[model samples]
Target: MSLVRVAVIGIGNMGAAHARTLVAGEVPGAELVAVCDVRQEMESWVSSNLPASVTYWQDAEQMMSSGTIDAVIIATPHYDHPEKAIQAFRDGLHVMIEKPAGVYTKQVRKMNEAAAASGKVFSMMYNQRTNPLYIKLRDLIASGELGEIRRTNWIITNWYRSQSYYDSGGWRATWAGEGGGVLINQDPHQLDLWQWTIGMMPVRMRAFCSFGKYRNIEVEDDVTAYVEYENGATGVFVTTTGEAPGTNRFEVNGDRGKIVIEDGQLTFWRLREPEPEFNQRFTGGFGQPECWKCEVPISGVETGHPGLIRNWIDAILNGTPLIAPGEEGIHGLTLSNAMLLSTWTDNWVDLPIDEDLFYEHLQQRIASSNTKKDKAGSSSQPADLSQTFK
Candidate 1:
């Protein structure tokens, strides 16, 4: 099989992982053509560990213009996704960007428009859908066995990040740098899952968020949001980076029964048969509701981030459908912006994220945000498997 030439922008922790996967050939039909980063030493740092065949550049525009790449992965800071990936589009390369599509909805829209104009496969790094347990749960819901999803709630306080974690990089936990906190970073997975599972976006939302309670960042470190869907289904999303050993639980209650996913496992107590309301011809006060008798075990192909990279390469090379399209990324970003705007203004923020008003507010926050970089320029990388993967 022919390999797809791949180039990557941003040589931070996650970007390095993407490049290594391509170099090791774990992502079938993918080759690491080049790497780029803003840091002057980042190119050499990546070159030292990669095969000598792979090129390196300090500027993405220069690297893409060098006519050596087929597709590009944009993994830079929050605001850079639009400009860099749009440039990639202009260079006739397919693009895969990280989450939020930059901190503002307008930027995401602009990128989406560019993707439309280029007619190339445009994707986002929403890797959570690849997780097997969540996919299985989505299946159960789609089967109509869940029976009218009434309420969905998630308390994702398990993402307890220390001050050091926030201070580890310059483009982290600041409005100017990263935009928002838990909701923007740690909770994007949950937010994506929320919309993906429900198959709908909220009509309106009201939220309350805490700014810099536990970390030394300039944006929110905690958030509580209430959302209402078009079908009248309601949801509560509570997330925080401040709480230690908190809770990571998703409770989905329907007219039929309830399903819970916690600690990386999915458990559903399916009713033995149908509930009493289905055969409600007679009085229903004489007996209790029937219940199911088995625990569903979830299994998925453990590809981590490489799965997404492989999918994008296949889409660009062989005309496979994209797993996470650029348009879907905007929904979560709009929801997030609405939540933040609601909290900041002390009132409910309506749906579709009043783009102009929200942008104005975000500009103020970003302008005033002080990005305090950590002395430690990097975080520990995940164990490399190039020896085995190769």
Candidate 2:
């Protein structure tokens, strides 16, 4: 294919944004041939917003079999992500799924397996990976310039949401619908980056998750999780939609030095000598390894969602490598699931989590969930996506 023909499977906030980007010719090598949404209200949205040449479908299966597109961008609900992607892979179409992969790992595992068997390009919309700041951090750690990672801590509570935000989407913030809370929704990017930058996953996690703490919802609105990695590294991930004037700070401390990312700037406190060596050789009492505060320069605009979409399209058309492989998406979800599982079991949860146990717990929640589907409306608020990316 000279140009990858792409169809968006959900016309929700994020999906609509993707469609608009494709229609505006932003992603050079891709074409938005069709947009699909189950909501009847979206028919008018398609007519008023998108080009007349672009087709609209209420059914995704029909769109997949119609052969009008070579790939699909699945932006449906969390539960629908894996199911739709698996079907798309079977139909021999490349797939791009939105974040968090899926609500649970068991279903997502099957989706990954199907993707592997189909030999189709599968990518995740981990737009944050395209940010230059995160890219530099990952490089610094991978290149061993920072030495072995010793600790990771991220306090990303700036994803504050109003009660109306939860009330806007019926499927949101409910066990039977969206499955989880801030961890699954607003914190996926950070959760993904926490491990991606350090190139490691925690061996175990113990989390405290507050359900309906801030919002009038059935799911968790606050959380504080502590984790330990296999290499003796420790981490703390704290997030909530409850606090106002919140903070977004990420710190990674290694043997050589430490790096901090906050206020849209990256700063590194470089040690003159390795801490271990400095500690061993220092004779003076209360001495430190002389540190120099350096501002790590980060240049280039973040490509965000469009950039990831472009990467997926390029990989499909020209055999280019994907920036955010769909398979690695499980790593972030694993962390989130472990956090929930830890809270559910009231104990520490190990890595490579018990998928069956998690599924069983999730089913119990779903069965007991009093969450009403379509509680408000299917459409999301008019998103000022610019405010959301940081």
Candidate 3:
């Protein structure tokens, strides 16, 4: 296909922004053929904003079957991501799904299988992968400049959401609607980046999650998770959507050096020798390895949503490699699921968790969920998503 005709499903906050980006010709090889949303307001918005050539459909199935699009961008709620992607793949369309994959692995695994079977370009909206700072960090670790990773810590608490934000949509922070809270919603990018840069998934996870600690929602708003890797490396992930003037510091210590990313800066402490080699050769008992602190220089601005979408379109049209393949979304989701499962079971959940048990617990939460009633009373409005990208 010379040009990949695209349709965006679920014209909510993120979806509407995506539609606008495509309509503005932000992605060179992509065309906004159609947009879909069940909300009545979106049809009016389309009439006011989009060109006549860009069609709007209230039903997604009709738009997909109308043969107007070769690809679909699934930006619906958390639960609909995998389901819609699966359907799109079945209909022989490329798919770019939003984060967290699904609330649980069982369903997402099926979606991944469908994508593989369809042999279509499947990608995820992991825009953080496009950040030059993170790209450099991943390169540093992969090149062995940082040696063997010893520890990892990320304190990302800046995802502050007001009660009005939650009240904007019934599915904003509910078990039955959006699945979980901060972990599923705000921490997907960090969780994806954490494992992506470190190049490993924790074999065991012990987490403590506080449900509705600072919010009126049923899902968790605060969490602290500890994990251990197969190589004996440990990691601590702490996050909350409550604190103001919040922190976004990610630190990783390795045998040869340490790297920290905070306040849009990347700092690296270079060791003269690897710690293992230094310890073996040192005679002085009260000494540490010589270290030089350097500010790592990074070029290129973060492309964010547009970059990922462009990459997806390029992959579809030019057979280029995807920056964030949809299948790998399972890794970060596994982390989130392990954390929630650990809290739910009050125990350390191992990697390759018991999906059946996790599903059971999640189903119990959904059975008693209060948000289903409030879904009808939804008063969702357009949100300024620019601030939420970080």
User: Highest lDDT among the candidates is held by which one?
Assistant: 3
Q: Which ten-residue region of model 1 has the weakest summed lDDT?
A: 374-383
How many Å off is the CA of 271 in candidate 2?
A: 0.5
Ranking by TM-score: 3, 2, 1
> Candidate 3: minimum summed lDDT over ten consecutive residues — where?
373-382
Residues 224-333 of candidate 3: C-alpha lDDT, one tens digit per residue: 99999999999999999999979999999999989999998999999999999999988996999999998677988999999999999999989999999999999999
The global C-alpha lDDT for each of the candidates, from Candidate 1 onward, is 0.78, 0.87, 0.88
Clashes of 1: 0
State TM-scores per candidate: 0.91, 0.95, 0.95
Q: In model 2, how large is the Cα lDDT of residue 18?
A: 89
lDDT of 1 by residue, 346-373 (tens): 8877788789988899888877888632
The root-mean-square deviation over C-alpha atoms between each candidate and the true structure, in angstroms, is 4.0, 2.4, 2.3
The full ranking of all candidates by lDDT, starting with the best, is: 3, 2, 1
Q: Candidate 1 vs candidate 2: which has greater lDDT?
A: 2
Question: Which is the winner by TM-score between candidate 1 and candidate 3?
Answer: 3
